[model samples]
Target: MKVEQNADLPKTTHCNKSRRNLTEEEKEARRIRRVLANRESARQTIRRRQ
Candidate 1:
């Protein structure tokens, strides 16, 4: 008898298709802006403490 390993398991169709959907550039831009804002806030805090 042959044994099937975990790696041979079948994947769901949804899993294969879902990854095709990606975030838009506008959404990415917004995310970057939020990160920069947080960094700037942290810098201000350190400067104020000094």
Candidate 2:
């Protein structure tokens, strides 16, 4: 039996523009979002466990 290889697969993408650093406000917003997501996840877990 013979196996075929994918030659057109890309190893990495070439991003022309580098990512910029997030400011303090953006960081705070991200933190708030994370907290809310975690809270909802915990609620769902508790409901499932009950």
Candidate 3:
């Protein structure tokens, strides 16, 4: 009637580090640029609405 609990946590890992989000400086810069562009576009949209 008693159920045994899982003692070991399931391993969730990628075999290669490349599979993870290991962005370099250039990639990080690109991400920031995209975020800034999105924010600017949103502001422009709000201005057009008003």
* Candidate 1 local lDDT, 1-50, one digit each (tens): 22223322334455665565445884676566666666666777898999
Q: Higher lDDT: candidate 1 or 2? A: 2
- Model 1, residue 39: distance off in Å is 0.6
| Order of quality (lDDT) | 2, 1, 3
How many pairs of residues collide in each model? 0, 0, 0
| Local distance difference test, candidate 3 | 0.55
Tell me the tens digit of each residue's lDDT in model 2 across 1-50.
11123222332356344756657896776666666666666777898999
Q: Worst 10-residue stretch by lDDT in candidate 1?
A: 1-10
- Candidate 3 at residue 30, lDDT? 61
Runs in model 3 deviating more than 4 A are 1-23
Worst 10 residues of 3 by lDDT: 1-10
lDDT of each: 0.55, 0.57, 0.55
Each model's Cα RMSD: 17.0, 14.3, 16.7
List model 3 lDDT by residue over 1-50, tens digit each: 22122212223354565565544985666666666666666777898999
Best by TM-score: 2
